[model samples]
Target: MKSFDIVTLTVNPSVDKSTHFSGLIAEQKIRCKDPLFDAGGGGINVSKAIERLGGSSLAVFTSGGPVGEMLKELVTKEKIDYEVIETETGTRENFIAVDDNTNSQYRFGFDGDVLTDSEVEKLLETISNLKPKFLVASGSLNEGLSSDFYQKVAEIAKTSNSKLIVDTSGQALKKVLETGAYLIKPNVGELAKLVGVERLEIDEVNEAAKKIIADGRAEIVVVSLGPQGAVLVTKNEYEFVPAPNVAKKSTVGAGDSMVGGMVWALSQNRSLKEVIRWGVACGSAATMNEGTQLFKFEDANRLFEWLKNK
Candidate 1:
């Protein structure tokens, strides 16, 4: 298995279409630029981000209908390896349109079609067989799929001795925590909820993360502070890396880029210090790109260097 085969599972994948328009007028027609299509979802974006850093990962996701086929084509175009679980219903499509006059983005998303029991079983089977060194389960679970599905994936990870890195929100994340994970990336707001608090101050971030680790919910907790950068906390070690200021074009995929960077670093056996820095560097670098695109290796490397000194 090459010592560390990284596998990413993205069950509710989407074909993301991004474009720009001048303005939004209720009564008038709006003209938009030609749309750019990209395959999207949590784990898939993570795979794409890893590829940008010159690493490889298997993006295992569910696909159906023409939209699903197009999504696969896009992933192939990126030169990332993948395993698909074909479904009866079509994959969902997400729309992101930017208003040029305001420079604000409006995102509209649709729920993915439900998967049959057999398809769901195939997903679990594929994950079990891969037995990668690191398994990442990101994005939202489908409508009919229970949150306990992640609970099952967590169990599979445990049985396979795979380090599971999760980057999901809401009940799905909660379920993974219950089963325990090697790592999880939750934004500060999500962290607050996990600890049963309304919010957390900057200094309190470490304590909040430590609480989860202390409970064995996760071995390592990475809190995304957005533009403030991110922090990595374990039972005994803590590292905080501040984000370097940059010209950000879009915020899409920044969090996934962070997860991808950290997972790739983990596969390389990089230290936690290096891991967090690489994560912050990749995430911040992702914002410097246009819509639906991730970071370039050079930008991420430069940012990592800057973060290393800090």
Candidate 2:
């Protein structure tokens, strides 16, 4: 087994198929453009994003049946090192379509195949043994899996002294907070939910994140504010970096790209300010591409430079 500075876990990986159509009409056969296939899931996208930034990480995910095989091939094509835990059922596939006329993207996601008890154990064992500097558990839980899955990963990271960065929502996110992670990236809405609120205004973002940090739920809390940029909150600090304006294309995988950039910067021992900038830069640049293509290295670099001066 090869060693890695960072390791990403994707229990519910997917084969993402995307296409474009002129318009969406009810019960009508819509002619669409050629389909594009990409491997997608939270951790998988993060690993892909890390690679774009000239960094390497071990991608650990579950694989089963034909769709799983195709997912492996796609990850391999990206030149990412990975480890797979085989299961009994095939992986799920997601569909994304864009209406060229309205420029609206519609995404249809499917439930992942359930994992047997043994398969779950194997995944935990693999994670325990890797013991990387950082452990990132992202994406949703599959059917038949407990919502406490990420909480278990958090416990493993705690015992191994690995800094855990989690990007998930709902019960999984809430559960993981109990074990406490090093960092967590929740958008304003998700943050609001975590803190038990209907919504959070930009002004209240800092206080909300500080409450999490105060409770030791996370050492650093990053709340993504979309076009307004993002806010980084620690026990004693609060920093907000504005998003640079860019020609928009698609938003797929943008959040994962942000996590990837921030994690890679942390691995390199960059300052918190620089880490947040890298995150925003990567995320903003990802909007320049169609479908799940993520960001271009040149674009991210340019955005990062512009952010530094602003």
Candidate 3:
């Protein structure tokens, strides 16, 4: 066993296709240029962000069909260590359109095909073999898989004595908590949905977080509040980490970058407060880039320093 620092599991990965549009017109031809294709999933993005931040992680997920093959090639090109389990159904494709004139973006997504029970078993077995120090379960569950799919992964992580961090929504997140994950990263909207409440105010954020922690489902609850930064809630602590004010760009992948930063900090034995700083910095840095490309290391470094000094 190589004792990897982090192992990321993505159930539904995709080939993200981003194209630039000059502008939108009613019933008019809109030519798209500067198309960019990259392998994307919450976990895959996190792995890429980790590498960019000088951290090490192994990318483990399932890939199948023709899209799967291309995705495998993409990961290989990025030099990311990965284990791909063959499946019967093809992976998904997510589309993003950027406006060159206004520097804005529009995104469209698709749900992935169902995974057979046997395929799920194979993934569970593969996860057993790797035994990474920490496990990050991100993205959505494929069709036919129970909402508790993340819960099962959490069980595997616990049995292997690995810390588990879950980034999911709705019922899937609810079940995953039953398995006792170490951390959960939910944005404001997601947090509201999980608890069946309206949007959360900064004052109410801690209350919502406390409800989840009271059940002993998760040790740490990170509620990302977009431009307002994030709130960290634990049994005995509640702290709000503010984002360094910066010009806003495309908002894609900012949350995932935060996850990557926090996990990297945890791997280095940094304090939770310090991890929050890194996470906020990464998210702020991500807004500096366009489309799906997230946080540059140089920008993240500067933001981290500024955050620490504040």
State every prediction's TM-score relative to the real structure.
Answer: 0.97, 0.98, 0.95
Candidate 3 segments whose C-alpha is farther than 4 A from its true place: none
Relative to the true structure, how large is the alpha-carbon lDDT of every model?
A: 0.93, 0.95, 0.87
Between candidates 1 and 3, name the one with more favorable TM-score: 1
- Which one wins on TM-score? 2
Alpha carbon deviation, residue 256, candidate 3 (Å): 0.8
Worst 10 residues of 1 by lDDT: 1-10
Q: Candidate 3 on 182-291: residue-level lDDT in tens?
A: 99998888888767798877788888888888988888999988777888889998878888998877777888889999999999998888888899999889888877
- Order candidates by lDDT, high to low: 2, 1, 3
Error (Å) of candidate 2 at residue 168 is 0.2
lDDT of 2: 0.95
Q: Rate residue 3 of model 2 by lDDT.
A: 94
Q: Residue 193 in candidate 2 has what lDDT?
A: 96
Task: List clashing residue pairs in candidate 3.
Answer: none
What RMSD, rounded to one decimal, does every model reach? Answer: 1.3, 0.9, 1.6
The list of candidate 2 runs beyond 4 A from truth reads: none
